[model samples]
Target: MMHEHIEALRQRFLHSGDDADLPIVDAHHHFWDLERNYHPWLRDVPRIPFRYGDYEAICHDFLPDDYFARAGNHRIVKTVMMEGEWDPRDPTGEARWATALHQRTGLPSAMAAQIWLDRDDVTDVLAAYRDLPLVRSVRHKPATVPRAAHRRDFSAPGSMRSEGWRRGYALLEASGLMFELQAPWWHFEEAAELARDFPRTRIVVNHTGLPADRSDEALAAWRRALDALARHPNVWLKISGIGEQGAAWSVARNGPVVRDAIACFGTARCLFASNFPVDSLVVTLDDLFTGFKTIVAGCTREERLALFYDNACALYRI
Candidate 1:
């Protein structure tokens, strides 16, 4: 019944008028230059266990021209580049590359630089990013287990729960940078505590908390986790990475998750993104954003603008 209602609304929305002209600030995306830079996940022998499974399709170069061509008519006025995992040895290299890329292309206006918060040089790395103009935030995906069943035993060294990690995390506020977190829903409880502990540091939750399992039980737990995280004033959400593994993207399947995220965090705290190239494996940029437009069709124009553009500008300072 819910799917039918959402589909009906989606149909109504498509007929009402398209949002091709809606200016967008893509809050999350990535660019990788495989020929010049080394991304182990893409170039390595045994690929890391990826959620998208068999991602050989995205092993080549992806640049701004490629992005805007795929974007079609949607006016993407600005974008925040999530750090493409460049070699871990040189953490500041990706930000420098993005800065130069901006100088040449004027796309990806800002970036989420890569930094392992738990590393010994965390302060020095933060200081480096503080000097880079392109860096608005930094992403170091906290350690997490593959499945929820293994969470109890998942006491990895760099996990968000570790004191050592928290010590480094506390410095972001002074550095004037936000923390971009890409953890699954099971980790939100810990994330919420981190947010409360460091009320001054802004934290953006990537991928709608990664609700991969869509079963009734799983969704219930996901919602509960989202609720817990949303209680923190410092936490923000990027509405991307909601793609299902095998099933193709669709409004009926994903719209509710989008709506639920907005309900949990509200439009002011939410931002839209195209986790592109990675998501390109599941759906085209056009179709994925079209689904986003359809799902939010009932919202006021101001609210829609906030989701697609204004909120990202405010959050990323783009």
Candidate 2:
């Protein structure tokens, strides 16, 4: 029954439209070593049978080859690797791992390594990882925890006000590294404020700030926040992660949401990203990029190029 449901969802996205053979540069993705890391959330989720070994075992090694195969002929020439849930045992180990992967894959033109700002030694940590050839940005991931059960209820008042966190963010800005914001919808205002405050820092908002479920109020809030963020020319929005927010995974369902984001962020400030392994929880790589193509159908060739390839190259300095 579960397999049947998954198949139906896949077909819904697959049949949405023909794949437009545009060259793509996926801005965000992840690779993991089950043996070396612990994904506590995966184990706690009852619906998924995934374990540390299950990802590699079932996918035959979740490496660049696997990503390229799934991306097919889309010319995914570059990718920016994000930190998966780093092993708590080795907080800085994820950066080391990404460095190794960059050497091996020769694909992730750059990486946005994860750092915990809550830690006292975050400055030292960022300094250490900044030396890696592919390290271009740092992700504090403040939105990893949300206050609301659904994204609609989220607000970032208290979270962004942390003195230590703000100081760490200053450190990231001073180091000339981009800050990747992965917060829920409510945090968009705070994110915009951060962007405005740190004018020199390039802020990349992941998952279109991850809007709440579709509704007039939700759309209005998302638009308001997005518009505010756009006032800061340095802020960029990544159109990824909409599928996972749906009731059930389907690219067709995610299309409008992503389109709304693109419309708000515009082509230059907007970029396409495959949230990969995380997005794999919702749709396959082909379906994900196919959905992206559908959302950007109204764009001109130049606009499409910027969204899919050019923006990423410029953002990550690939």
Candidate 3:
């Protein structure tokens, strides 16, 4: 009987055109007006080619209108805007800007601002973010990818295990902000340790442990990381950014990764996201969500609801 239900849902999910009727709370995505905000990576594109070369297509001002236009075919009820790397000197500037956009446009239902946790004024920064009604979480994306992987390591030597970073992480629960962590699989054990030590703190692991290498050895490491982190009830996974893993954007290619991740974390722990603009470098918004819907076709409608909206609402408190 359960197998019959699963197959029925799969049939509906596959045949459904656009799936535009379903409500979506985009757990991750970004909104940036490049002219007003400063993104170092976006600005420095010419000199340093990002991992996926020749990204001239997405080099533009992507605002709320642009996002909704891109999302015309889907019922995106809400979005949690991940902090764009606004100028680092005034760390809270990005959140403030995003808050104002939320007030004016009503697009971003909530926000996750970026903070340099190791800095001295971190508490003051977190406090200001807390003042904004829309701010629900914080992200401090340090480089966990080893230089041996031929990627730049911007994080301090210890990554999540660094003393100062831990000190700052301790403050999030009290401040009403969850931590949004973006790191490679190598740092998952450290992330698991962080989750255990600060069980009070809610952490959302970004980009599905960023299985960027995708070799059999790399996939094994990524799975180990996901498995370890899923042990903590407080730790949740935002399943997006598979596009950056060097695979072509297609349901056929991405299905295995998505299916395995959901199996690992379960529907209750998984949050669906577009990772737009950043992910737009690889595929269009429509293609991304459509592919995602197809990949999870076997899930029951209730499970699909949790994946698309309910889980995001609970995790980010949206």
Query: Taking the tens digit of each residue's C-alpha lDDT, what string does model 3 give over 128-228?
Result: 87688788888988646562653222345446767888788888878978899887767777888889999989889888887777678878767877887
Model 3 earns a TM-score of 0.89
Better by lDDT, candidate 2 or 1: 1
Model 3: lDDT of residue 105: 86
Q: What is the per-residue lDDT of model 2 for residues 145-191, given as tens digits with 9 covering 90 to 100?
A: 54355353444333555666777787876788888888776666677
Candidate 2 accuracy as TM-score: 0.82
Residue pairs that clash (backbone atoms under 3 angstroms), model 2? none
Clashing pairs in 1: none
User: Candidate 2, 41: how far from true, in Å?
Assistant: 3.8
How far out, in Å, is residue 155 in model 3?
Answer: 10
